[model samples]
Target: MIWLALILLAPLGAGLAIFASRRAPGALALAGAVVGLVGALGLFAGATGGATVSASLPFLPGFPILLIANPLTATLALLVAGVAAAVLTYALGYMAHDPERVRFFGTMAMFVAAMELLVLAGDWITLLAAWEMIGFASYLLIGFWHRRAGVAGAAMRAFLYTRSADLGLYLAVFVLIGAAGTSEISATLVTTGTPALIAGLLLLVAAMGKSAQVPMQDWLMRAMAGPTPVSALLHSATLVAAGAILMIRAAPMLPPGALLAVGIVGGITTLIAGMMALAERDLKRLLAASTASQYGLMLVALGAGAPVAALLHLIAHAAIKSSLFLGAGIFQHDRDSTALEDLAGAGRARRGIFAGFAVSALALAGLPPMAAWFSKDAILAAALASPAAPWLMPLALLGSLLSGAYMGRALRALWSGTDSQAREPVPFMAAGMGALVAAAVVLGAGFGPLEAMLGAVADPKSWIVPAMGLAVGLGGLALGWSLAPARLLGPLLTPARNGFAIAGGMDALVARPALALAGTCERLEAWLFAAVLSLGRAGLATGEAVRRTDREAIDAAIFALVERIFLMGGRVRRLQSGLIHRELALAVFGIALVIGVLLAAPLYR
Candidate 1:
């Protein structure tokens, strides 16, 4: 419990310290990341074999901020912590010379902390809060270069797009609370109710948005405007992966229809994004599309009731993608260009980088001796085990083929170029790549332990299943290479370039209508206000006329009353005498006059 709290708060605390002591923000961030890393490892070690560690906060009496480490949480916590550490180390080198290094490091730390909290959260409310925090931190990191309009715009789009989906999660939480009488994830999942199913669907919508699947995907492509390190963290480890993690975590509560829906969407996104990666001319954008494609595969795994497979794929992808992004960054920094055409002869100049890029790319393409090969094979096998497995297999195979084709093309473009375009590699950058490549090789070659670790999570007869999947994936790659030179592939290339028009069609169909409706509402509100103002003016004129009439009547009545009062005063003054005796006589006369006035005024009516 203490370790969990430390893990959750360390990065946040470091961010605060960095803010207060801006001179050493990078150092503070590094320290916080180290602490988080230690805590995560401790949690993982303590929670092996499905053990759980939990603690409740006193401040939140009825709904304490809880952190629990089960096999699932431990696995994710380790991944988040490990990647955060690597990224921070890279950031130390990347931001060492920047003027706003403190701000950069601080935001990055906060982002990492939020992801940790997300993985540790035991309840829906806590998870949602962490989810928003991650999104918020991502917005800041993406728009770090605030001076650039493109960066700012991309940041806003990301925020707005994700927030739109977050609303669904908010509603889902409310529904869960109403139905289960608790916000705890465990209780919500165990309690059977119509609202529970509804809440699950709503939460899935939020996951889809955060994951950048289908309609919400354009924001990610735009997000490339941020610093390359930010992209590396986002695409590889943190922001995008959170959605898949959420879905996997909550899989037990998801309705069958919801799962199937998720699978269909995932399959479609994978194919589309893979194709788009093939058509992209920019190196980073190609990687961006590839990230989306890989995430889609994870989603399919989760939807096919294979959380372990999804998670393994996620971890594998993170290692390879991070290295790819970092490599791309180095290439861009050295070459001063991100365009594929301009990168000719880069391989001859930087053989190490080219080799690193190839290894990572093949792993991403699910080639042999890479982690992607094992994890991706598991997903395909799981899909084959499902009712829609037959149809899904072909789609999965096609997506894999597209991924290999594009990644191969990218590799050729990088290495086939002349030696003149490349420069000497940065040591730290090369070290990062080498570490990731080593990890990929280890996981790819020695997947036996990983499979054993999965234990119950692994499907029955998994050995034969996964091996068959690998064969299919490799065959697709071979076929793609053979067909690469043919003009007949043009249509497929166009479709790949457009990512099946999913994001583009979403913008035109859904986003535009919502915007148009908002615009119409604004115009109608203005017209209504103008009409109300004209009516108010007319009402004011009528009120003034009535006021003038009332004022005249009041004036005449006051004047008449004053005149009567003056006459009465003249009669009363005569009764007052100068002397006491005269006054007494006047008093008697006044009493007699009052009696006479009363007798005269007293008519029976």
Candidate 2:
């Protein structure tokens, strides 16, 4: 419990401190990462020793904020913390010259803190909050250079797309919580039948959005507008991983229909994204596409009902992909661009960095002795053994082939360019990338023990799976190295380069429609405003008429009558003047007139 608290607090505290002091930004971020890493290590150690630590603090009445250090979550915590530390270390050199280093490091630390909370969350409420935090933090980080061209748009696009999909998660959580009568994630997993199926599909929707699958994947390539370290952290173990992590955690609760949907989505994304990678002219965008493809393969494993296989691949990918990005970042620094054409011979100039890059690229291609090879094998095994083997196996194999092909193409491009003059030393950057690359190379050896630690059953070992993986991998690499992408992709090249936008992809499907709807709403609102204003004007006019009538007609008549009475009163007062003889004569005349009127009245009657 203390370790969990530290894991969440350390990075958060450091981030706040960086913002407050705005001094020694790199040092503060690194210290926070180190502390979080230590906490994760401690948590992992405890989990391995058969102890599961859980902390529940008051939140909602029934749904307390729960954090747990079970074997799986603990391992993920370690991964997140480790990756964060390495990326922050790399950024030390990457952003050394940037003026906003304080903002960058502070946001980075906060993002790490949010990711830690996400991985450790044991209940739906906590998970949802952490999920939102990371999304917002990623938005801040991705648009870190908001002044740059297209950076803000990319950040906004990423945010809007993911947020739209997050509705699925919200609905799924609602369904799960309602069905289970609790917000505890494990408790909700016990829910079965229609609720489970609905929740599963909804979860898949959310996963697709976050993990950059298919149509939702367009934003990811654009997201490369951010800093390289942002890419490294996001693509490797944090933001992009959130979707796959969600799926992996929820695998047990999915129905057959939902699982099939997941598999198909993954299969499509892997092939499509892999092609996008091959067609990419920019190195970072290629890597971004590759990240999507690899996560698709993880989805493939989950759909095959082998979440352990997905988990293993995820772990391996975190190291391999981050290492690849770090290497790319160094090259970008050297060339001042991420364009493959600009990066020609960048590897030759920095042979050491290039070596690390090559190793990780090959590892991603699933060659033996590398971490990804082992995990890829597990995924391939799962695919082969799945009930939908006919559908899934081919997709998995081709995805692997595409992985090798794109990586090979990237390597060839990097290696074939003219060597530039040696540049300045980047000791911090090199150290950070070196650690990840080493892990990428050697992390496979521990998979067996890791499986045992998680109590995950190892996939049945088979010669066919490895043999197939190697053949496709090698074949794809050879093809990419030998043939140009225009020749390889042929008719598909244009579509692939355009991200296979059938009918303008998301813009047509989501954005344009949304914009049109907004326009319609705006028009409707205008009409309503006009109508309301007209009604108000009519009311004012009616009130003015009533006032005019009261003043001219009714008031005029009353005033005229009052004036006549006043004149009569003045005449009557004059008659009461102190002339006695005149008064007596007037009285006698009045009496005679009254007598004559009475006599005439009686005769008429």
Candidate 3:
């Protein structure tokens, strides 16, 4: 519990310190990342003993904010911290000369802290809060250079797309909490039947958006407008990973209907995103598409009822993709652009960096002795053994092939051209990327202990899975290295380059409808405003008419009677002027008048 607290607090505190003091931001961020990494290590060690550690803080009534450290959460926490430390180290060189290092490092720390919270959250309440925090933080980080052309728009697109899909998560949580009568995530896993199916599909929607699956994927490519470190972190273990993490966690609660849906969605996304990757000209966008494809494979594993396989793949991908992106960042720095044409020989200029880049690229291609090889094998194996093997196995294999193709193409492009003339020392950046590349190289062998710690068994070792994996991976590499994307994609090239939009993609499906609804609401509000104004005017007119009636009719009659009485009083005063004789005559007149009134009253009755 204390370790978990350290993991969340260290980065958070560092971020605050960076902003408050505005001094040595890099050192502060690095310190926080290292401390958080240590805390994750400790937490993993504690969890390996099979005792789950958890702490609860009062949040919602009857549902506390829970933070738990188990094998799964601990492993993820370790990945997050590890990747964060590496990325921040790289950013030390990457953003060293920037004027707003304080803001950059502070936001980076905040992003790390939010991810830590997300990994540790044990209930819907806590998870939802963390989920929202990451989205907000990513928005700021993605649009970090808001003044840059299209940067702010890219961030906004990412935000709006994910937020729209986030509605599914909100609804899913409602269903789960209602069905389970608790906010506890583990408790909600027991929910079955319609509720579970509904929640599973809804969760998949949120996952798709965050993970950059299929139609919602264009935003990720646009997100390359941000900094390289932002791209690396966003694509690898933080914002993008959040979606897949959600699916993997919720795998147990999904029913067959939902599982099939997940598998189908993953399959489609894998194929589409892979094609997009192949067709992409920009290095970062290509990698962004690759991230989606890899996550789609994870989804395939989950859909096959093999979450451990997915988890392993996810762990492997975090290191693999981050290293690839950092390498691309190096090339970008070399050429001052991420365009493939611009970066054609950027890697060649720095052989050491090229070596690191090639290693990760091969790893991403699922070559043997690389971390992704084992995980990719696990995914293929799980797909092969699945009930939907006929449908899933092909998708998984093709996705694997596409991964190799794009990576091979990138490597060939980087290596084939003449070396760039300019050179710059990037000790910090090299060190950071080297650490991740090393992890990518050696992480394959650690899955055994990881599996043991989680107490989850992967698919039985099979020769066919590895054989197919190798065949596609090697074949795809050869094809990509030899042929151009035009020859490969052929007639499909246009759509692939356009992100393979289906019925105009999410813009038509979600954005247009939302905008139209907003427009309709605006029009409706205008009408309501006009109607209310008219009603108010009518009320004012009615009030005026009533005031007129009171003043002109009722008050006028009363004033007329008062005027006649004043005239009668003046005549009576003139009559009283005579004295005694006049007084007797007045008394007789009053008596006669009273007698006359009494007689008239009797007659009228």
Off by over 4 Å in 3: 420-422, 512-605
User: What residue pairs clash in candidate 3, if any at all?
Assistant: none
lDDT of 3 at 519: 88
Local distance difference test, candidate 3:
0.92
Q: Candidate 2, residues 121-153: lDDT per residue as tens digits?
A: 999999999999999999999999999999998
**lDDT of predicted model 2:** 0.93
Give, for candidate 1, the lowest lDDT window spanning 10 residues.
Answer: 479-488
Weakest 10 consecutive residues of candidate 2 by summed lDDT? 507-516
List TM-score per model, in order: 0.81, 0.87, 0.86
| lDDT, candidates in the order shown | 0.78, 0.93, 0.92
lDDT of 1 by residue, 142-243 (tens): 899989768887887777778788888899888877878877888877645576568767877887788888867767787888888898889877899888
Residue 46, model 1: Cα distance from true site in angstroms: 0.7
As a whole number from 0 to 100, the lDDT of residue 590 in candidate 1 is 90
Q: What's the C-alpha lDDT at position 448 in model 2? A: 89
Model 2, position 283: C-alpha lDDT score:
97
RMSD, one per candidate, in order = 7.7, 5.1, 6.6
